[model samples]
Target: MDIGVGFEITYAARRAQRLSNVVLAKARTHTAESIDCER
Candidate 1:
């Protein structure tokens, strides 16, 4: 059970990282578009 808990935490952390990257990429993409429009 202890090993299982640790494995679950590790999996969750990886998932969170992937999600964070997606969100950050979206923000960067939108910012770039807005800048292009302004120019």
Candidate 2:
């Protein structure tokens, strides 16, 4: 039971990391576009 719980926690953490990475990438793209528009 303890091992199963540990696996679940790790899985959740990995998922959260991937989600944050995707969000960061999108934010970076948006910022670049905004800067270009301002110029």
TM-score leader = 1
Model 1 alpha-carbon miss at residue 23, Å: 0.4
TM-score of 2: 0.91
**What is the lDDT for 16 in model 1?**
100
Model 2: which residue pairs collide?
A: none
TM-score per candidate: 0.91, 0.91
| Deviating ranges (above 4 Å) for candidate 2 | none
**For model 1, which pairs clash?**
none
Q: For candidate 2, which ten residues in a row score worst on lDDT?
A: 1-10
| Per-candidate total of colliding backbone pairs | 0, 0
